[model samples]
Target: MRLSTILRGGIVVACTAFASGTALAEDLAFTLKNATGVAVTEFYLSPSNVNNWEENLLGNDTLSAGDSIQVTVADGRATCVYDIKTVFKDGSNVDDRAINLCELGSYTVHE
Candidate 1:
């Protein structure tokens, strides 16, 4: 299915009919878009109040520029606010703080 994208700023949240089909507590999933013109070697989302980065969401997969992936929070953390961290293949990293994952349908990361 083709999902509509939300373009606001560096961190965007889409509001489409497909996105509202899931329940927040049962399915904490969101789309992650890569637009940094680089391969994302790692992706992480940690609770806003947490001090350390969570496990790599991408695992062994790499997200190239213009690509997107579905990220699901199955660890049982129900917090809407999170800090995102993306590590590029060139050993570079970018961090976006205090993003509401619950309200976010799709998050597009831009350079």
Candidate 2:
């Protein structure tokens, strides 16, 4: 009986750790830019990882010309998908020019 209990407990702990590791797990930085040469009162940055978009980086709703907003993800992951947008400045859109500051980090699990 004691052995069975120990085994069950061990399995539960392992599963819990795995589940927690995958929950909202990601890491990256985002920056928004204004390519319209105008002040964007509302701006946003949408970022996503391999198969998750909702959990990605979502930016604010406002930004000025030449101004940018930044956020860092903590899971230490990189995403190739991102969007920069103008939230509510009239004559603006979700499209904007951007310069990637640095390459995304590599996955530790793959290597």
Best by lDDT: 1
TM-score, per-candidate, Cα-based:
0.74, 0.39
lDDT for each residue of candidate 2 in 3-95, tens digit (9 for 90 to 100): 110000011234655777754334454444444455555333345322322321223333445444444444433444544444445553444
How many Å off is the CA of 31 in candidate 2?
3.0
Please provide, for model 1 over 28-104, each residue's C-alpha lDDT reduced to its tens digit, 9 standing for 90 to 100.
67888887788888778888898998677776668888888777665544577889998998898889999997887
What value does the lDDT take at residue 104 in candidate 1?
75
lDDT scores of the candidates, listed in order: 0.72, 0.37
Model 2 misplaced regions, further than 4 Å: 1-24, 45-61, 73-78, 96-111
Q: Scored by Cα lDDT, where does model 1 land? A: 0.72
